[model samples]
Target chain A: MGRTSDAREKILGAAHSLIELRGYSALGVAEICRTAGVPKGSFYYFFESKEALALAVIDDQWATQRSDWTRVLKSDAQPLQRLRQLFEETEAEQLAGQQNCGTVSGCLFGNLTLEMSNQTEAVRTRLQEIFDAQVDMVDTVITEALARGEVTVSDTRAAARSVVAQLEGQVLFAKLYNNASQLGALWTNCLALLGADSPHVPTAA
Target chain B: MGRTSDAREKILGAAHSLIELRGYSALGVAEICRTAGVPKGSFYYFFESKEALALAVIDDQWATQRSDWTRVLKSDAQPLQRLRQLFEETEAEQLAGQQNCGTVSGCLFGNLTLEMSNQTEAVRTRLQEIFDAQVDMVDTVITEALARGEVTVSDTRAAARSVVAQLEGQVLFAKLYNNASQLGALWTNCLALLGADSPHVPTAA
Candidate 1:
């Protein structure tokens, strides 16, 4: 049982890494199996199909990210400080990935959403849930900041969504330019969106 | 000569549509040829390969978009109004695509950037060029706004990039959720980014 579970973890890890390096449709099961050092039989034993594997990968990635982000949001620091830390860590991670791969690979959720959302319903729906959950988390953080008078935004929901979108867009740009430095403005621009750095008029939420 | 030109246009049109519906990596030359109603021989005659075809597609798409955006930026309205109109038109266009396809497809250049940037050098370089040209256009528009005293920002370049990133991120979310309405916030958020609705400090340019 232990060996079987170990094989499953290995396959998932390999699948995630390969799909990260390449787009979803461009990778094949054979390559994943080879990279995992698992035979074809073991691959199917763990994942019913490639799509099944992808679903698991999405869940796994989102679970890890959610925990990490939740930890940041739940931290004792000021909400604004926590938000800045989140984006700063994001930049550092991308920079590190660029160092390893010679180019920044954008967020897996965003990448998968763009690549597979239109083509696969299951994946698309799951990606949407992941994104919505992420936005909700941000919304909660913003709401907390507002309660504390740490940030001033007319619309917390819009502010949260815009912040997430800007980060994703910056990551996309960073990846497109093949320069992790393109994300240098992410933190500052996000703050601007939240009305953290300046006074803002209250608009209809 | 006219027949050859017609065939080329058909191929380019089909390739663009297929790619927009699917993605860069998911579509194959054979499928493109079938959709275009062109033969394999004709496809080869017109474009050297799929990569070459993709380059042409990028150029063709950018040229069309550039003309439209230039007209918007050059319009007789206030610079800020022109910017608002640009974003409104974007949302309208995206909604139209969603109406036709039942899913929001986001920006083609951005979708391609997320899908192909790390995978293909030729496509990635072209995407970077396309994105840079877009930012330059936005920068020009913002500069014109500054000269006219319609908006205030410290760094026109950073402002331009942030606006573009926010819009792209909104589109990505719209597509992810299969909800064209996700872009509803694009215009408002964009105004906020430009400091149009609020006075902004001039940061380091």
Candidate 2:
């Protein structure tokens, strides 16, 4: 049982890394098996197919990400400040290992939306729900801030969508330019949109 | 010579359509030939390989898009109104298509950025230049609005990036949801950010 679980984790981890770097279409089962250091036969033992493996990777990543973000959103800090901290932490994660972490490879969810949304309804619906959840989280933060008079916006949903959009756009730009600094600019602009000062300062760690 | 040129254009047109629908990686050369109604052998006669064909498609699309955007930006209309018109036109084009347009397919440049930006400096630099040009154009429009006191913002660059980011994000969302209506909401929210109203209304062709 222990060995089976370990092999499953290894496959998921390898798929995450490969998809992040090379994208979904470019990743192959052989590459996943080789990277996981597992036998090809073991791959099918864990996953029904390559598409199944990709779905697993998506679910794993989204689950962890949702928890991490939910914790930040529910923190004791002020709503606006908490949001800033969330982006800051994301930046820190991207910078970890000298890599631009903040979904700069583009949201694995967003990437799947573009690639598989039309071809596969299962992938499409799953991605849309994930994105809708993300947008909802941002809307909650924005609404809380609005109710507290911490921020002022005529429309909360639009503001939330704008925030998500900017973040998504920055990730796309960062992936294209290979520079995380553009993300900093995006963060600053987003703050300004909310009528707040830029809270993101590059940290040494 | 004219026949050869016609074949080349047909091939490019078909490739563009395929890439927009399915993306570059999923698109096969033989499929492009079939769509173009050209012999499979003729595909190699015009292009050395898929990569070469892709490059040609990118260049052609970029040129046409640049011209289309430039026409809207340079029109003798109110700067802010011109910007609104740009989005309106884009939304219309997206609505007209059966699937999300190229820019929403994540921008051919952005899609390539994810797939090849890390692997090839030549493609990376070229894509960066393309994006930068887009930013510069938006900057010009925003700067003009600022100069005319049409919009209120302390940082024009941030405003410009925010606008572009929202557009890119809307593209992704529209693609994911398979609904262009989200784009209308996005545009409405963006116009609100600029203290304007949504200009998109039902119109006849």
Candidate 3:
């Protein structure tokens, strides 16, 4: 029983890594099994099919990511400071890991939404819910910053979406160049745009 | 001679449509031949290999896009206004087309950067050159805007990179959602960040 459970964990770990590397659409069950050092038969014993395994992987990654982001966003620091720290930490993680998925793989939920969500409404709806929740989380933090006059924007919701969009773009750029400098550049630009040191110059130009 | 030329055009057209609908990696020569109503022999006659055909498709599409964006950006209007118009027209085009490759299939250049470019330095260098040229174009336009006092930024180079990054993110989002609305949303958000007037804000979010 112990050995079988260990193999199952190993298979999941391998699938998660491969999916991150090549994308969920490009990965195959056989490849995951091989990478996990498990027999093909063992794959079936653990997961019903490749899609099932992928869904499982998505769920696992989503939970971990939410926990990490929540911890950072809810820290004792000021909301604006917390947001900046979140982005800074994210930039550092991407730099150190040479991986852009967690920060930018365009949201694994967003990715699955494009790949299989249309084919399966259940998946589509689930991903939408998750994404909407994430947007709301950022919205709350940004709103707090606004109330405190730490950040100023014409529209808080739109600003939140732009922040997400910019982060997503930086991730894609990082993946394209296989470097994290673009991510750092994005953080620096975003900070300047929102920094308290700079007065909100609505008509600076 | 006429019949042979017609057949070749059909093959290329079919290959382009299929690649945009599915994906380059998921498509096969046999499928392209079938869709085009041409035989396997004729496909070989028209193109040396799948890679050759893909490269041809890329070249054709890139030329068309270059002309389209250049015309929009170089219009007889304010530099910032012209940039906003370009984005508006792009939003319209995305909504009007079916199975569009512009945002969905991704910038063929950006997509190839993620896939083939990593394996082949030749392809990588070609994509880099294309992207660098794109940045230069954007920089010129943005710098013009800055000179006109239409927009302000601490770093023009980083802002240029950010614009390209946002465009890439929009494409990925469009492809994932299979909805042009997301592209429009991204465009509107971008315009707001650049301090342009956008009529796309939802009445209720």
Candidate 4:
């Protein structure tokens, strides 16, 4: 049982890294198994197909990211500050990824959304739900900021979508230039998007 | 001579559509050749490698989009209105793509940026140049807007990056949801990012 579980994790980890560094369509199960140091048979035992494994990878990354998002967005900090924290932490995470991998990997979900969404209905629906949930979280924060008279927006949901869309776009730049600092604009950009006042200097991480 | 030129154009057209529909790595020369209805020998005659072919595709697409961008961004229209026209036209283009292909094939450059940036230096350098040119064009408009006091931005270049970045982000959503309307927020988001006043209704397209 221990050995079987170990093989499963090894395969998942290998798929995750490969998909992160490259992308979904370019991968093969044999290579994934080879990288995982497990036999090909173990892959079939774990994931029914490469698409299934890609879905699993998406699920796992979202689980980790969602936890991070909830922690920051739900904290007791003022709603505006919470949003700032989200941007700062996002930049930090991308920077950390750059240091580890020699390139900023951007958001895995955003990456997969562009590369896989049109090709697979299953991936498309899953990504839509994930993004919907992200917008929901950001919308809640914007509503809070609106109530406190800290921001003004005619439509909170649309504001949140713009903010999240801006983040994804900036992250795309970060990955293209291999410079994580491109994301530093998100804080000010978000404030502007929401019609909030210019930001205070973010508290240092 | 005319027949030979036709064959080359055929290969280029087929590769462009295939890459736009799928992506770079998942394609093979043989499949592209078959789709092009050209002999594999013809592909070798026109392109040196798959990467070289991708560069040609990138160049061809950019040439067309640059013309469109220049026409809109350099027009005598009010500076901010030019930006609004850019967004409206972008959404229209995506909508047209969805109607033709049953999918909102996104900015071909952005699709490649997320999927191909880290994998190939030649492709990466080419994409970087393309995006830099995009920012430069947008910077010119933002600078014009700032001069007129129509938009307020601390740094016009950074502001241009934010605006372009927002467009890229929103386009990513439009593609994922297969809905071009996701891009309608771009003009408003751009105004917010530039610290401009709430918009007057954009003149009808």
* Top-TM-score structure, candidate number: 4
- Which docking band does candidate 1 fall into? acceptable
- Model-by-model DockQ, in order: 0.46, 0.36, 0.30, 0.51
- B1-205, model 2: which lDDT tens digit per residue? 9988899999999998887767677778888999999888888889998878877887897898899889998889988877878888877766767343433444566556656665566667777787787778877887787688766555666566567767777777777776666676554444434433223521100
- Model 1 CA deviation exceeding 4 Å by range: A197-205, B198-205
What is the lDDT, from 0 to 100, of the residue B71 in candidate 1? 90
Highest-scoring model, DockQ: 4
Those runs of model 2 whose alpha carbons end farther than 4 Å from true positions after fitting are A97-104, A195-205, B99-106, B186-205
- Note the residue pairs that clash in candidate 2: A94-A101
Q: After superposition, how far is residue A59 of candidate 1 from its true place, in Å?
A: 1.2
Give the number of the best model, judged by lDDT.
4
Q: What shift in Å separates residue B84 of candidate 1 from its native position after superposition?
A: 0.4
Model 2 Cα lDDT, one tens digit per residue, A1-205: 9998998999999998887776677677888889999998999998997778878888998999899999998888888877877777766555562354433465677666666666666777788778888879988988888788766566677677767766777777766766566666555555545644333431110
What's the C-alpha lDDT at position A93 in model 3?
68
Worst 10 residues of 3 chain A by lDDT: A196-205
True contacts kept of 1: 0.56
Docking class of 2: acceptable
TM-score of each: 0.93, 0.88, 0.83, 0.97
| Worst 10 contiguous positions by lDDT, candidate 4 chain B | B196-205
